[model samples]
Target: MPPSPAQIRSLVTAYLDRHPGEHDALAPLTSALDSAGDPTSRTTLPGHVTCSVAVIDRGARVLHVLHRGTGLLLAPGGHVEAADETLLAAALREVEEEAGIPASALVLTADFRDGPIDIDVHDIDASPARAEAAHQHDDFRFVVHLADDAPDLTLQVEEVGGAAWLPFEEVSSPTLRAKLVASGLDGAIRPVKLEQHAAEHPAPAVRTEPAAVAPAGAPSGTVPNIVGVHLYLERDGHVLLGRRHPDAAYAGGSWHTLAGHLEAEAATAGLVREAYEEAGLVIDPADLELVHTVHMVERPGDDPRIGLFFRARRWEGVPEVREPDRCVGWRWWRAEDLPEPIVPYTRVAIEGIQAGRAYSELGWAR
Candidate 1:
């Protein structure tokens, strides 16, 4: 005859009181209460106990198995603490800490059963070392949803040796059930081993370039005339405009096309790279048709600057100020109704884009 529900509850409560801080010892106490069939005899065992269990699922139909060095397989569960106000809190906490999954991500699939009579404690320690251990949990069990298709199991290294999903048919055996029950007490299954290999691998060396010296022929602090690509993207006859951030030194509070200075380090791909970063839009470099390259010699004693403008017929994503420090706003405006206080260089590029000219030879034309 199975132990009465009241007797089982009393046994669990007593056991919990004796093992105040022993998390692993609760397994044996549970096992002892489970095996006691006589209601009168059950009183001999500890009665006070508080523990938690998790019924985890992977949103599928397969069962997760772990090799925890115990002969029996079981679900994931552990003892509750004085700080744990309720068993549900304890159950969710244990699953996350032991399984490395967030509690919020797990969906509780079953109602928690109370009383020791509803629990099972199987003891099957094939190993002599585990058999002699006083506080070893042979296994613990949880009913988790495993799909017909297997899901990836990322095992917590400290708690489980290895984990896998086994078919229900493969697990429905008396011998396997006994082993699973033992392992479940500890919340682990056996891990698979792999082979080792040794091979020759070489480390690469790093290279460095020397600092540059000022050329005697050139003036001091002369900004180079960078040949860059400017994108004049027109949608429904309105040109896309990128508003310069107020903090910019040259063109603060001015609107300009998507453009940047060419970098020698980027080879011929600087235009493609800059267009994407400045406008938060991507376009194929090959698709950019060179609309014009303006050769502008700055006013005497002013920094010399040159600009290359390109028109792209195709691109991806809506324009936005990806770098708020460099650009604060963006909008689409018709060529006839341009925004005020536009930069002189940007104005020249816009004129060329509007005229549909292939090149604009500009030299202090203002």
Candidate 2:
């Protein structure tokens, strides 16, 4: 049955309540969805809604199709069609079309009959081949269990390389793994809770690199890069991330490591100031560890960014939201349990930390 506008709002609202950690991450997306003149239309610009499903077997194996175009494994789903009556209907239709599974063989839990299993909002890369500009997608994810232990399946050859059922741990791609983790299929999604300034420790050691200089060219004194520092705060079994407020100029509603721009000061000093101002944490120059540096350019016209990502092994004060204007709240997250729609560069840094890499770059011409 098609859901009425009121029902749709109720379903989405309850889904967000179950996942408070994503409240900050999905704040603006939800706001736009709720306030739209003609909500649920796929043609909406800047962002749109898509539906996908995580297909699992009785043995807890997940189904994945290797996308031929991008050569990566992804779930079965697509944009909402105008004829679609509801989000669940759209997700089920994609599964049936992409997996060639009979409707009777898919087990839709009654718990999810009214709500999605998870929600992911990610930025879309703008490419000339596809007409989409720089926009985002609020992907509603549902879970379907296979009734039959073994079922006959066919592939959408034009889009998929092959399809397989494997344990969640066996998923090889980092992006795919992160999405699976976010979907809560393996029970890794962490709940949202801000740890107030509870306890304090001595400041950590610090080291920082100098700001990048302009290249040798026609004229002088030009600042070619924006210098920023991101602190990787670690506690007993989790790391800290702040959710950018919905009213911020950029990255509003995305979870990011503690970071701020360098303002006429050394990166080390700037980081210290930002730590106190943003998270109410104090540190010494000696406890900081240089884990990685990211040289990234968001677009051709935007200034390049030289970011120093530090690992703060120890610091004084429990994580807190000292600056309400910048970020609304803070939460401790496991690497395997990070929420969706994180700042893309910050996600790269977290992955680098797990893989023991020292540095990386993004959005640069190869």
Q: Give me the candidate number with maximum lDDT.
A: 2
**Candidate 2 lDDT tens digits, 53-113:** 7776756677888878777777777777654556766776777677776544554432343
The 10-residue segment with the lowest total lDDT in model 1:
197-206
How many residue pairs clash per model? 54, 11
Estimate candidate 2's alpha-carbon lDDT, on a 0 to 1 scale.
0.66
Show model 2 residue runs off by greater than 4 Å: 1-5, 170-366
- What candidate 1 gets wrong by more than 4 Å, as runs, is 1-224, 265-268, 361-366
All-Cα superposition RMSD per candidate: 25.9, 21.1
16-42 in candidate 1: lDDT tens per residue? 463355346555555554653432221
lDDT values for all models: 0.46, 0.66
Q: Residue 123 deviation, candidate 2, in Å?
A: 1.2
Best candidate, TM-score: 2
In TM-score terms, candidate 2 sits at: 0.46
